[model samples]
Target: MSSTLLFFIVLAAMALAYYIGRQRAIGVVGGVSQINRLHSLPSYYGYYAALLVGLPAMLLLLLWVGLQGQILTALTLAELPPEVTADLSEGQLSLLTSDIRNLASGNLMGRDPSPAVEAAAARFQQLQQIATLSLWALTGAVVLAGMAWAWQHTKPSFRARNRVESILMLVMILFSLIAILTTLGIVLSVLFESIRFFQMVPWTEFLFGTRWSPQIALRAEQVGASGAFGAIPLFTGTLLISFIAMLLAVPVGLLSAVYLAEYAPRKVRAWAKPVLEILAGIPTVVYGFFAALTVAPFFRDLGQSVGLDVASESALAAGLVMGIMIVPFVSSLSEDVINAVPQSLRDGSYALGATQSETIRRIIFPAALPGIVGGVLLAVSRAIGETMIVVMAAGLAANLTANPLASVTTVTVQIVTLLTGDQEFDSAKTLAAFALGLTLFVVTLVLNVIALHIVRKYREQYD
Candidate 1:
């Protein structure tokens, strides 16, 4: 059975268990009228029974689903003759399994399968059927056993509420650990692969070298494929675009925020805020198309008219569109932060004979500065991490220049390029993606720390 259908079956069983347990609790107390004799409420008994019925079945399903793939693969492969499997390497074996999987799923898109692969695919389907049947049978039996146990224990003196709460607490902890462990697993995997990449290419060169070519020589005879692994150009381009974006985003977004939060009429604020924030809802690819088709062309033509060189895909166009895109993030957050400032500050400034502008500059703006900084920081992150816009508007050339008019690329674009298509995971080229990911992580972390420091330094405390 499919997991979703099985889950619903379990849910139905839990409901049955709950009803039976509630009836049993009432019976043990001599009737519904005498239910006060029970240690916990009858509904608590019902909840306890539902938990008992569901938990064991869910665990069984999870374990079965986890091991089902590997077990079936092994059984399918084993069904093939020794001669069929004897010479294939691990990558080839993986591909064979993939083909079998696709074929069993009726994908029928890849190369025609050999007789051995056809046999394996059939066997895989058969094993999958058997495994799913066994899963359903085992889960049903466990659910029945749990219902019986709960029915037996649903008595007047049972502390059903306490036991159910304890079980739920443990489950909450388990889910929390799942989230933490998932993050840890991702970090460790990237770190290990980055270590492998650094072994193949020097860390110093990757970090500080100005040249950014990553086309490593495949054979000793290849002349132009000598790799230069410097990431300085990637970082430079990322910052230049992000810098341009922030330059446009901050002042306009901040001032607009101030206006909306303090000066705008309620009627205007109602529709205007959502309209302004519509930019954030627009897809990045749409922004990319706009930049490539309209913004980039306009910039190139304008620059040409002024007798200045401008690449077809320049950082300026991408950054401007990106700045427009991120405006909502800055405006919405800053407006909310400004509105959060106590009205007493404004009142005090007015009482001291200060004008509205003076009150905003001296009191409200300063009070809201930390939160505004936070919004701006989020906008900066958005600009830095954006890929689709940069891909379309800024051409993918990792030129080590400070010029925003020149075509350049960010680390994210290169990461995507390196990992695209069929790749040997152990190759230095594929592994470079991990190194770039790690670098981006470190840079973002540093930015977060610096932003936090600034926020703390200028933070205003209120009574």
Candidate 2:
């Protein structure tokens, strides 16, 4: 049977186990009226029985399904003659198994298979069928055994509620550990790859070098193939664009948030907030198109009319559109934090004869400063991490210049460029992507730490 069908069957079995356990618990206490003799409610016995049946059976099914492919492939390979496998590397052997399984399942292979490959494919299919049948039998047996054990243990004195709670708590803890470990694994993996990249290219050059050409030549005879990996220009471009984005976004977003929260009528606020937030739902790729086609051209013409030089694709164009994109994030978050401030504070300010403007500036703004800072930080991160807009609007020149009209590139754009196609991971060119990623992560982390310090300081001063 299919795993999905077997999953539903297991669920049905668990439901039956629940019913049986509940009835048994009631019977043990003599009747529903005399259920006070039982330690827990009859529903607790039902839950305990369902848990007992489902947990073991589901775990077994999950492990069996996870390992079934490996086991089948191993059996198929073992059945093949020793000489057939002796010449293949680990990677080639894996590919051979994948192709055999694909052929057995009536899928196309890259080329016609040999006699040994055909035989292996047949063996794989046979093993897969046997494995599936065995899984169903084992899972059903486990469910039945769990049900019987639950039925036997559903006595009046059994602490079914405690057992159920303990099991759930353990499950929750296990999931939490999995999440923490996943995050740790990601960081360590990036850190190690970045270390490898640094080992090849000096850290000093990568960090302070002005150019970022990562095209390493495939052959030593190729001219101009030794690429530079200085990231200073990328860093400068990223900061410049993000700075411009925030410069436009923070004031517009924050002020709009204030007006909507404190000045707009209820009828206006209801529709205006949602309409404003619709900007956030628009895809970033669409913003990229708008930046490239509309904003960039407009800026070019404006700069030309004013007798100023403007690149066709420049940081100013990308930043302006990016700023518009993050407006909703800033406005929505700031509005929420503003609304969260106590009404009592406003009333007290009014009683002290403070004007509304004065009260907002002195009391409300400072009180809401932390959340405002947090919202602004989120928008900043969004701006920094933006790829499509930069790629489409700002040309990837990586020129070390402060002029917004000049063409520049960011680190994210470089990372995307370096890892765009099928490439070897061992080369410094590919490993440079990992180094760039780790640097971005560290920069973001530092920014967050600074934001936290700002929030704490303002919170202490205001509260």
Candidate 3:
């Protein structure tokens, strides 16, 4: 059976177990009015039974789903004749196994299959059927066994609540560990791939070199194919665009937030806040279209009218649009932070003969400074990581110029370009994407660390 179908079946069984366990608990207590005599409530007993029926069976299903394909492929490979396998490399063997699976599933394999492959395909189909049947039978048995055990233990004196809570704590810990381990796995994978890339291209050259070409010739004799891996241009472009975005976003967003939070009327704030936040809900691709079609052309024409040279696709256009896109992120968070400032602080400032503007400037803004900074940092990060707006508006020319009217490309755009098609993992070009990713991760992590330090320092002072 499909995993989804099996999951629903397990859910139905757990429901039945819950009902039975609840009834059993009531029976053990002699009457519903006598439920107070039990160590735990009837609902707790039902929860305990449902968790018992679900957790173990779900765990087994997860394990089976994760490992079944590998086991089946290994078994199929072991059954293949030595003549068919002996000459095959690991890559070839993987391809052969894929063909067998495709053929067994009645999908086109793209090539005629050998007699040995046909035999293996039949065996794969048979084994898959048996695996499905066995999984269903075993899961059902486990659910039934768990339910019976839970029901037998559902006595008047049983600590059902404690058992259920303990189980829940363990599940929570398991999920936390899964999240931590998954993050570690991603970091390690990117680090290792980046190491491979650095081995092929020197770390110093990749970091400090000025040229940014990443195309290498396939043949040694080919001309003009020596790739340049200097990443300075990419980093410069990213910072330039992000800086422009923050320049446009921070003052406008923060001032707007201040107005909405401290000065605007209730009705105005209520309607205006949601209307402003609606910008966040629009898709980034739509922003990209606006940047490329409307903003970029307008800027180019305007720059020319003033006798200033401008690229058709320039950083200013992308950054302006990106800043507009991130305004809601900053304004929403900043407004909440501003509103959270103690009313007494504002009152105290006013009692000291300070005007409302002076009160906000000295008291409210400082008190909410930490959260406002955090919001700005988040907006900056969003601007830095944005790919679609940069891709569509800021033409992918890895130019290392500070002029906003010039074209530039970002690290994310280059990473996408590097790994877009059917890429060989071992090639420097593909490995470079991992290097770029790792670098971006490190840069973002550093920014977060700095932001956290600032927040903590201010938070301690304020608290």
Best by lDDT: 3
TM-scores of the models, in the order given? 0.91, 0.92, 0.94
Tens-digit lDDT track for model 3 on 190-253?
9999999999999999999999999899999988878999999999999999999898889889
Encode model 1's per-residue lDDT on 322-381: one tens digit a residue: 999988999999999889888998899999999999999999988988878877887787
Q: Candidates ranked by TM-score, best first?
A: 3, 2, 1
Give the alpha carbon lDDT tens digit for every residue of 1-463 in model 2.
7999999998998898889889999999899998999999998999999999999999999899899888888888989999889989988998888889899998989899989999998888888888889999999899988998899898989999999999999999999999999989999998999999999999999999988888888798998888899999999999999999999999999999999988999999999999999999999999999999999999999999999999999999999899999999999999997887788889999999999889889989888989899878878888888899999999889899999999999989999998998988999999999999999988888777777777667655544
List the candidate numbers ranked by lDDT, top first: 3, 2, 1
Question: In candidate 3, how many Å is residue 353 off?
Answer: 3.8
lDDT of each: 0.90, 0.91, 0.92
State the local distance difference test value for candidate 3.
Answer: 0.92
Kindly indicate the candidate among 2 and 3 with the higher TM-score.
3
- Which model is ahead, 1 or 2, in terms of TM-score? 2
For every model in order, what is the number of clashing pairs?
0, 0, 0
Lowest lDDT block of 10, candidate 1: 454-463
